[model samples]
Target: MKILHTSDWHLGATFEGIGREEDHKFFLNWLIPFLKEQEIVVLIIAGDLFDQTQPSAEAQRIYYQFLLSVSQKTDVKKVIIVGGNHDSPTRLDAPAELLKLLDVFIVGGISVDGKDFSRYLCSLKNEQNAVELVVAAVPFIHEYRLGVRTSMHNESEIHSLFKEKIQNFYFDLADAAEQIAQDAPIIATGHMACRGSELDDAPQEIHMIGTMGGLPSAIFDSRYSYIALGHIHRAYRVDQSNAYYSGSPIPLSIKESNYPRYVQLISYEKGSKAKTVQKIEVPVLRKILEVKSNLEQIHSILLNISWQTPMPPILAISVQVNSYHSGLDLELKNILKNKFQDASPIIAYIRQIPAKSDNNVLASKEAFSLKELTPEQVFLKMCDTYNEIVDENLLQAFRSLLNEENI
Candidate 1:
């Protein structure tokens, strides 16, 4: 059977502050047509359908509309929606029965040990092939739901407890798969990380924390036909066909700059030993571009970039300017406004300059200038400035009063 594997839609997400409603709409518009053309039967949205646990009303309406549209437009038999860290399981799974009537299966917020999960072996006839598959759907496991106590001291201890609890769930899932699939094939689906072939760019110094990390590959055995994973935002395979993460539908962060956002079309044909696999890329609305250059070069680069296309609302625009550019601070803002305009979706514009010479001078051409700070730092500084301007005298008086009391 032909299945479209996609995840991390992060609907209602904005690039910086710019809205992604258009991007989401564009995806839905193209997706319906694509599914029809491909003659896809199952569409597996692995997880993070929404960017936040509590989505906005408009986001909810649009999300439901997209689901309904797909159900109406395609010959799709099942749309499996799992839960990721960003989704509230209760919220996504609320209208389960109603959605089932529409042929959409919302499987978010599932617990590993929870009874009455409604997961099982199912069969469908596609061209009389009698596609038999057992589904073991696992949602993003929150520690609180799993009954794992956490008065732990450090990352390692916390991770240890998490692993122990989650592994039991995996074993239970395996047992279920073995029992249900019988001679039929089994496919495991989860919104958790499973040590995919790609390495996360997260620092080595860091330890697995809460839902941010994933289980190792060893935990996922070959008993199942394949394992479909989500959470990580890049399309990657753990080994080859056995396990894979269908990255986010749109580029969510600047770190995902190089990876092309896509969905995978997986076709499974039963083999003597293993299931034959085919992976095809389903193109999305936005293409992420990363350009590095100085202010002068950037001006030229922006002009060269075609903003007319539906660029991703989430942009990580980085600018590397000379530290001593007298007008760079002011020019950068003007350039972003003029070139990007209000229509452009530039979420962040990062400016980095070479470290200044320790020799401080008013006009040494390389003096420490503008007091280098991050965007967050800049905001804090502005707040500090406003506070000083408004309450400087009052703060001094309070300090003096405290000093007198101490004396």
Candidate 2:
């Protein structure tokens, strides 16, 4: 049997501020043909089907369209989708009955009863109606969903309790799967952060039902033939040979620009213990180029860009400047305009890099002083630092609050 493993589609995500609808459409269009060519029997999407919990209308359209295509257009028999932390369980589960008729399985989260481990266990059959694969479709296990009541006040105790609950959850589901299809190859799907996995971007705040830190890779029981994981954007293997993260199909952040995006294909026979895994690379629909250099270097790079394709790649330019130049941004914009007159590249962002300064110099009396500024000035300075825009009305509101505080 051949199964395709992919995750973190993050549909409706935006690159910086630019919408990724085109990029996602390209990938989905490409995926249908590939699945047919590979003659895949099952497609597994680990988690994070949509970027946001409440996806936009356009996002819903794209998601449904893809599902329709896969079910009707492709030769693939079955698809399994799990929910991530960003997914709303109720929303993903709303279409459960309808999608089931099309041979698509979705595990949005734990059932309302919370302790029903049987809900996560699913058995897949081939055209002969013989069960060939057993999957424990465990969605993102939040602590609250596990029905564990903890009175422990200590941080360590809370962490330990959460870990135990999660481990037990998986074990229960695996046991259930084993009971139903003991002879078939068992596969488990999960959406959670696992320890020792590499992250493509700088760590962002992740507050979920489980512990703030990731769970150990050893948590996955060795009973399953393969474990498909999601949550982390970068593709990598966990401690065991059978455990792997297929990663996001598209780059979600600038930090992930260089990471290769691919999906995994697994083939296993009825009685064989050994499974063959293949990494199928997804073609880059569009390029996200990040350039950090001096003014001259930036100008050269932009002018030298080969614009052979119809659409130019998005550019994120960061220029190192010793001091502020009045028309520097305008100058750079003009340069790009002159070079790509026919087809202008999308400018994602432009960052100004201030030169390094000595700490002692900054502490000196002559250096820039925040204490000498007024409350409004300080607020405006903060806005500049965070690259936020404050309208006149908002600025007035801040001033009024400051006045009330006598600052």
Candidate 3:
């Protein structure tokens, strides 16, 4: 049987308050037919279904509409959706019972008690209604949910505790999955960032090998034949393991424009232990481009874009200038938007940067005032100045406090 894995839909995503619903709509429109063509028995959305904790009503409509299409238009047996850091557990779980009636399983958060891990075991059956596969729907397991309960100032201590808790959480879930089904290949879903994405703790440790240089493949139990992961916006196989990140369907940020997004198709032949994975490229409905050049060359650089984008692109331009000039952004917007009259580019961002440093300022080191620094950055700088041995934990704690205070 074949299963399709995808994640980080971020439906209602926006850049500088500019709505991103069009791109998502294009993707969803394509996905419905794609699922039917692939004849995928199960569909897994690892996490981050929405871009915001409290998504807009339109965003919610897009989500439910897509699910409705999959239910009525496709022959998919099961639809599994887990939550990411941006998801509000209550919001995702509110209509859980109703979604299940459509064979769409939503797991926003694992129970805090951890006793209901077995409830997360979603069984996927074949046409004959015989159990063929099982999925361990593990969502974003925040450190606070574990023993930490809340963020504290001790960085090293908190990090160590968090790692141990994570390992134990998976171990227990593995135990629970095993008890339910032995012969069925146990596939697991997760929404954690790779070690490379969280490199603040050990910046020196570069992943020259598997899982994009961060997550230990061993963290996942061996029983899981295929581990579908989300949170990292690029599709890659975890080194030394069976885990794979299917990545975001559309480029969410300018830096991600070059990333070729894809959804994964994993197949396991009947009574065969081997699993084969196929990467299906997602169609680019709206293009995005970034231009970093001086003001004199900005227009030429944009004009020289060679990509035959499916649609007129969204542009993020960083213009280097010798000095500040008023109305420069507007001037460029008016000039560039007319370049493609048939499908004009949307100027999403425009920033003017100094082409050269101030003549009087020292070039030895860059300097910025406190106003330019976030409170956490200032705290870290103070720690460094005092020779205090601090780590990411302290920084996280500071941010947690700031979040609580709504700073």
> Candidate 2's residue-wise lDDT over 1-407, tens digit each?
78999998888787667898888888898899988888888899998898888998999999888888898888777889999877887899999989998888999977777568677877877669877888888887665555433332334554677678778777777778888875888999988777655433312213232233666766777787889988887777776557888888877766565767889899997666469887778875667788788888988998887643236777877776667667777788788899878577788777677645564333222223443354556788789879998985565465434423321
Can you rank all candidates by TM-score, best first? 3, 2, 1
* TM-scores, all models, native as reference: 0.73, 0.82, 0.86
Better of 1 and 3 by TM-score: 3
Residue 379, candidate 2: C-alpha displacement in angstroms? 17
Clashing pairs in 1: 15-314, 197-238
lDDT by residue for model 1 (1-407), tens: 67788877888887546677777787778889888888887788877888788998878888888787887788888777778777888888889789889777767675454654445233444455644566676666655566644433244655677677666766677776676556666677766655542344221111233223556665665676677777777777774447788777665555564566677777765433344455555454664555566667767765656643556334444555435567654565566567768755453544455433455342233212232332323444566757755353443343333323321
| Span of ten consecutive residues with least summed lDDT in model 2 | 201-210
Candidate 3, 1-407: lDDT as tens digits: 88999998888788656788988998889999989998888999998898878999999999999889899999998999998866787799999999988899989986868767865889876668766888999987666666563344344455456567777778788888877666878899987755545333111111111113445667888888999998878887887478998988988766567768899999999966578998899987766787878887987876665556567778878777666779988888777666755566788778776666658333333344453355666888899889998865565566666544421
Q: What TM-score would candidate 1 get against the native?
A: 0.73
Off by over 4 Å in 2: 147-152, 199-213, 271-273, 306-311, 359-407
Badly placed stretches (over 4 Å) of model 3 are 127-129, 149-154, 196-214, 358-407
